[model samples]
Target: MDALLTVVVPVYAVEGFLETCLDSVRAGLTAEENAAVEIIAVDDASPDGCGALLDAYAARHGGLRVLHLSSNVGLGPARNAGLAEATGRYVWFVDSDDRLPPGSVRAVLQRLRSSVPDVLLVDHLREHPDGRLEQDASSPLLAGPATLDRLLGLQHTAWNRITRRGLLTEHGLRFPAGWYEDVPFSNPVLVAAGHVEVLNRVCYHYRIGRPGAITATRSERHFEAFAQYDELYQRLDRLGAPAAVRSRVFTLMINHLLVVAGNDSRMHPSCRRRFFRGIVGQYRRHRPAGHRVPAGPAGLKHRLVAANSYPLYSALRAAYRLAAARHRATERPPAVSPDLSATPRPVQTTSLR
Candidate 1:
């Protein structure tokens, strides 16, 4: 018999806080939910003692299981391993560094049972070390079955949701390993799911100050995103994505590339024109609809940025060649210590702040 839920957590060098993570997960679950929740902690062969710690947890806890990988397979593969081991009817992917507040597991389980949607989303609250809570209202709960096109331009952070196991398995959803993995991995899953449910209640407490987070260090990984979107587009095309959905996907990719390009003047000043040209060129190949997506500052910025970036593919390429390498040598998130940190870890607390 399948377990009710599989909570897959990919653990890295979080030994500094693994116990806290486990405590929180344990605390957040209801008695019944706890019985149903099978913790699959994928130890990515961290040089730290996280693997041993996971083993310890498994030794003490009947519901928790430890998976020790021979090599660090990165987030996507670690998660895939957990899924392969999951005997749960439902699956929720949670980061090991973060903690769930009280009742979160129960809430997610209840939503899964009542709604039975292909996916269920919970709002996440940003907690600063100072004990203040900033709500992530980016995605208020969305109701009913959502389509691929509708989910486009959607604010997605996969941690804040519980996905139906059948939906994922049926659609063959899996994350693409490496940087910017979420978009290619998540968007396709959301698209494939026929129905989705979202809750405004914040069930997740995201820990931002953790070391080596995606945005915590600066690296060439992001620049690779420009090419990643291109890959996503190619996959979508091969998959024979719907025309409307295809257009939305392209537009989304264009928007993401523009946002990141604008941030790095050196990279964009060099690559923008060529990159923009490539984008427009590829976009034209797709043959989008007569309805020009509403022309806004973003669209205008995309056009202007594209223009500024062009005609100097040589100079841009030259700059990017060095910049990515230089940036690659640097740490990710590029900056140490967030300029702003909020306080009071956010807790769903059953709809209470």
Candidate 2:
């Protein structure tokens, strides 16, 4: 039997959550769908017995495979290792701290078998620490093939998308070994894909880990995001995704920098200063060069920051937050949406650009 899907779950030090994740996956699939799946759990040299857990899963499951990294490579490298080993037509990368909401692999594969999109973006459920379930609010950014406006202007995360295996590997695509590597690779995926599928189903359950996730900690890349922003902006203009693409990109850059400004001591104080100054410079460049101003909270946040210093900035920021909270008070993910419709997959595809 040919495997239609390869599910890559990077094993980090989530000893507390690993078993539940695996068991949830096991319960989600049936004999036939499970049989058609190849599960790869890359143990990223976790010291917390996660590698042994992967071994145990491999021992019991006929379809499970383990990729044990020699050392603690970051998220991007661990995923790259799994990508190198994947043999499925489509790839679904699930974080160790998260799990699918049953039959998701089969659903994703069923869609890929016919519609054949470069990637399928699914709605994700974000689980709060208190066990409240709210569907992720940012899954619908790409209306079709990603444009510069869409990639940069809209919201995105790595957790809620499925990539076609051949398209990914043929391009020799791999995650950059950086803290927020997904930003670049994901943007490129949409840029390079012919068409993308947007499913409104909440298939993946993402846990919200405040104060502990690497994203909360300031690092070298935390400051380097400005460089990445500049690079993407230049690349998008070169690609001609549209002027709208630049608008989105501007929004992302502003949002990222402001968040850095708000970050207290997580990043080096000097690094924050450097990042802020760079953003101020970037804003000046955009203003003179005539880039579209970013919209929503991102744009408002940046404008407020540009006009004020510390205590004033903080006070103004609170108003924006309250306004945002009101805007989101009534929005919710679609309860019933397009599932794996029986549409025939496309036989040919070209670059989105």
Candidate 3:
């Protein structure tokens, strides 16, 4: 019998965290639940000892499968390789640097058996460097509705969404090889899914500020976001999605580009102008008809993007940063001195005699 769920983890240079991720998946699963789930770890030609680690772990764990690729394909293609080998009814593309919380697999299995949705969206906790856990702000939206807009509004990460394997195969959906691959893949799955369900519980722990993380690394590859969105628009056109959906996606694309433009960690200071120009080109190409820009500062940024005014956009961003710094400075609490004027009192002690 095929397993009910397949956890596809694409491993790269994540030797430091792979064991925690693998262990967490089986942490709270019962014998029966364990039999119902399978794990496929794709070693994307990682330069570290991740492949050997995977093999050793799989030797100990019954349902854990490992695939070692000869070449270093990026995360998307590695996930594709794992998906190709998956034998479960549903597939989850989990990152090797992240892990499921205890009981998360059980919760997901329960939901899948109950609702049988084509797609199941779960919330995640962002694990900061200081060991703090914070729920994603968008978690509240998952409980409201399963609408396309709502799904699109959620984080465009692949791990949060558990999709039926048939839904993906039937639609010929596969992650493209590049950065921001989730944008092209996740959105379309949500758009094409016949029925969608949301699990409000925090199921995944996403590590933030980790070394070698693409989001935190400064590189030119971040510009690939534009190409990813282009592919997304093309897919939407083929799907013949409604105007409203297209409009929402357009806004989302612009907002995403703006975020990339503003993130110092992702976009280098020297590349900001070129990235902003690319955003302008994208705005001109994919802007849906009769689309309304969002309100306030976001709307202003949209206008600047439409006008292709990189200079003004840069200035606006600078001003906003300055204001934010000032606001933070003003909001800081003053240090207080401890009082030393209190009279001394006799200490009371309890005797065990």
Candidate 4:
């Protein structure tokens, strides 16, 4: 059967959670949709048993195709390989450590086939360590045509959206090779796409705080986020994107810098220094006209960053830590579930660098 949708899952060291993730993909579809769905699982030279497990599943499944690379390419190149091989009309990217909720595939496919939009944006539930689910609330604002101007609030992860393969090819879009690859790739996709739709349902289960997960662990690689945003702005400019779209991306860049800077403990001094310098460079290069710093601590932080004031930046970090400690002191403990242990963990590996 010709696949209506192709799911591209780039697997690395995700052996501990791959089975559950694949299981969710299997169970999420209705019988008919399952038959029409094709899964392309790319094993980017996983150091563990993930490749063998994917091959085993492929051997038993009719619509599964497993690709094993000769060497460990990063996630971006692995996804490019899968995208090149996909034959489905529409393509969806999924992470090997995450999964789809039950009935999600069926519901998404129903809407997808009916509307056949160039890009389909959907919501996700963040699954915390204690088994709590927090659904993202930005989908309501995405209903109309003005979504490109509001890209910062949207989840930029590739898997949360299903996009037409033709649209990607038309725009000559491919992921950049780095930690913050999604920002460059996703921002352009949303900007170039003509027909976009948002599904307000929480279709994906995104695990947060899992050990060894990219978001859970921090490294100097986090600093790569600045370069990624620089790429985004460059791409937007080359493509002649509207000023409003460019402004939104610039704001998102600012937000990303603040996020990395706020984690003072995880960052080395050298990394922090580079972060401040890089953000200031981006602000000067990309800050839209009429953008003013609002009055607040955040505004002060932005101002300090603009001026490249190291002492004030350090002070802000200290203040942020104190505020966070107070908040933690006042917060109640999370409700723990008995099945928390059942939740899977990502495999630990240092090969991404």
> What are the per-residue Cα lDDT tens digits for candidate 1 across 54-153?
8888888767888999999888789989989998888888888887776677777776777677766665666655545565445432332333455455
Q: For each candidate, how many residue pairs have backbone atoms clashing (under 3 Å)?
A: 19, 9, 0, 0
In model 2, the runs with Cα more than 4 Å from the true position are 139-155, 216-221, 230-241, 263-274, 281-289, 295-297, 304-312, 318-353
Give stretches of model 3 more than 4 Å off. Answer: 327-353
Model 1 accuracy (lDDT, Cα): 0.66
Clashes of 2: 9
Q: Which ten residues in a row have the lowest lDDT in candidate 1?
A: 344-353
| Residue ranges of candidate 1 with Cα displaced over 4 Å | 129-131, 140-150, 234-240, 263-291, 305-353
Q: In angstroms, how far off is 86's CA in candidate 1?
A: 0.5
TM-score of 4: 0.88
Best by TM-score: 3
Most lDDT-accurate candidate:
3
lDDT of 4 by residue, 118-215 (tens): 77777677778766866455544454443456544687778877888998898788888888788888868777777776665667888888887767
My TM-score estimates for the predictions, one after another, are 0.76, 0.79, 0.92, 0.88
Candidate lDDT (C-alpha), each:
0.66, 0.67, 0.86, 0.76
